[model samples]
Target: MEVIISNYPEELTFPQEYIDNVKAAAEKVGELYDVANGEVSVTLTNNEYIHTLNKQYRGIDRPTDVLSFALNESEEPEIEGEPEVDVLGDLVISVERAEEQAADFGHSVRREMAFLTVHGMLHLLGYDHMEEADRIEMEEEQRYVMEQLGISRDDAKEKKAPKAEPQQPEADKKAKHKSGFIAVIGRPNVGKSTLVNTLIGQKIAIMSDKPQTTRNRIMCVLTEPDAQIVFLDTPGIHKPKHKLGEYMVKAAEGTLKEVDAILFVVDATQKLGPGEMYILERLQATKRPVILVVNKIDLIEREKALPIIAHYTSKYSFAGVVPISAREKMNLDGLLDEVKSYLPEGPQYYPEDMITDQPERLIVAELVREKALHLTRDEIPHAIAVDVDEMTTRPNDDVYIRATIYVERDSQKGIIIGAKGSMLREIGALARTDIQNLLGSRVFLDLWVKVRKDWRDRDGILRNFGFGDER
Candidate 1:
């Protein structure tokens, strides 16, 4: 099937990997049904743009997580076709709400955006979570697909550390509640998401070397006997070039303001650069205590970590200077202890088992994007977006999904599709494997390619592409 993606709202920001995830999920679903060749349209928009859509389409008058427009209104899945491609209709997402929700939930915008896409696609395919039974079924399917795609529920808890001597009575009876926001900030390409994932001990944020890979504030909650820390993995702080860039910067900056502590992650192996300085300046403005985290220490010698710590300590009076490698998971416990010290006593924000607040569609989107980003290199990484148009379960127990991969230009489109459609095929294959792993059942995935002609810079396009909301 062919999936088309377009953006509205003039200046919405999102990672290119999200688009790939949608396409991958669709192909996976298509494979399960043994069907091919369908058409799906997806739009990325901001809150203002989506709000208009919500008001005009559903009469809700307020922006929601997502809205699906299914041209094929029939309740049954379309028959596998010949001359005409199945017209599954359009999926729209709110970039603004995606960003806000990411921060509120403590995960990346990519995950939130992808989750919305998947959720909308499921709705288009007739999956509803209105009742308890329906909700359980849907939740299972969502989690199944997510886990198959390598996304896990954050609710999984870890075994408590054994005490050396005896547990304190007060510490044992009272479940320690550590609830507060910890913002991780740095320039693009610094392992901020990796650090957050390491701290939370789950893959909540999509990790990539691509600069500015994270477009929203992703929340990952970590709980213990006495504490719960909500870690916000934000877009890398960088100079703005487009409206989306401005929004990303705003997301990172805003998170810093609202959080209880800031974990300023930096590449310990590299010398301090302009990007590091830029983030440091912002960190200075925050009244909350800032912990200078020199991540990637595993790449350096043990002696090297000390000098790096000394250099940063000289530059700023950080609340604490911590050196650890997020990739190697070194010194994460120490970092968590420091983060807990900054959190004030507050009511538990989530259940003890809860980890992240993002929905399944967003996580699915991120998984697709991660595959794409890993497969493609350089600037091409930034110009892509994925949209899941439809996700359905047939009577036989197999799942079918339809999605689109969007680009700003025809050349970029050509590159994505590759010669003889080889590149597109490779991306689809890679995505399907992940999706199959996620769903635990056969996935019939259908993929399509189209050019949206600079949709990233166009407001109407952004709104149509699900980049913003109505307000």
Candidate 2:
């Protein structure tokens, strides 16, 4: 299960343990409902953002503690083949509201946040509280999950205070903070970007079905008052075919020695192939603790995943093995718990609000490229790269971005442009929405398509497009 947490507000700060609580809460709900193969996107935002969403979607002017948008209730598009990940739905949580309510109720914010996450996940699973009977059942389910997670009011009694006071803040401040860097390395297209995006609670890295989608080593930060985990989302370690491929492989292996730890993510659905064995062989040389992340467990049953887990465990002595659906956001709290055990006491490496080191230009360009990937077919090829020629703020505060999508063939350019520029328009419409969410402002995206033949093989051209610099 994949539990993606996206913190929208830059200034939102809280204890990192609350994230574990959130994941645990969501996982408990899954356990109760027997939903092992599911995905839940948990978005942490401020009242301002939630208020906007509430007004826009629910016709409510005020911000709510949580809002549920279950895809199960809607008509989700089905892929041609069997789906690898089953998306449960989305949960929009207002952190500001949760904090306020926690104070009002005289409980710790961790408890309040956990309740909200569990309550929200339940709603996404079709549990409702409109009627008295439904309300009773829903509350009972909530209590069961909380109890199962050992986070019930009774379970957390020692952590609670008589009243919210300055002493609690002081105690929190004095608590030892832990911070570390963990590199997320895996075979190509193993949901590394999805996992990182979910962990950071934002989409800083571009994601697609295409192999070698992530060409750069993206540094994503997850911060809390007590802990900060900076993640290095490296390119998939694969055999290189060109300069760009060699650079990608080199860049991925480069981080193994420098990072405090590593997350070796693999697809649970795929057999233990030579590519995976190759990565495991490389891991043999690294003394850094490596946590085996069995991703995409949603595609298979728990019983089936056992043998896959066994296959990898027999090959290498991992620091820990965590089965998760990075797309569904499942059991991530347990994964974090294992990570926390390895973190050393240290200073917070980055500010609480900074989520990623990628500049706006790169993110914007990647967003466009991701859209192009989604819009085009195999005939177009994966030889597309986006360059943001101009990105400036206009007088009215809207971002004016002029970007060009470079393809290897004229036919590919035509495919992206379409017969009447329809495809480009569609891409812009889709990419603009994500750009707005990322930028938090209205954006006027101007996109162009051009042919850059065999740029992947050319060193200067590849470097210009933000490749070969990872070392």
Whole-model lDDT, candidate 2?
0.83
For each candidate, C-alpha RMSD in Å?
Answer: 18.3, 18.7
lDDT of 1 by residue, 1-471 (tens): 666777785465455666676666555444433335666677878778878876665444567667778774575365665475666678887666665555444345555555566566666667766433565576666655555555442322211211133545864554334579888888888798887777676666777778878876777788665677878888889888886677678878888777898888888878987877877777776698989888888888888888888888888899998888888888888988888888987644543334576554555566667666777787485877777788887887677877788888888888888889888788878777767665555777777777887766777766554455321
lDDT by residue for model 2 (86-140), tens: 6889998887777765554445677878888988888887887644357668878
Worst ten in a row by lDDT for model 1: 155-164
The local distance difference test score of each candidate is 0.70, 0.83
Over 4 Å off, model 2: 1-175
The TM-score obtained by model 1 is: 0.62
> What is the Å distance of residue 368 in model 1 from its true position?
1.5
TM-score of each: 0.62, 0.65
User: CA lDDT of 228 in candidate 2?
Assistant: 89
lDDT of model 2 at position 133: 59
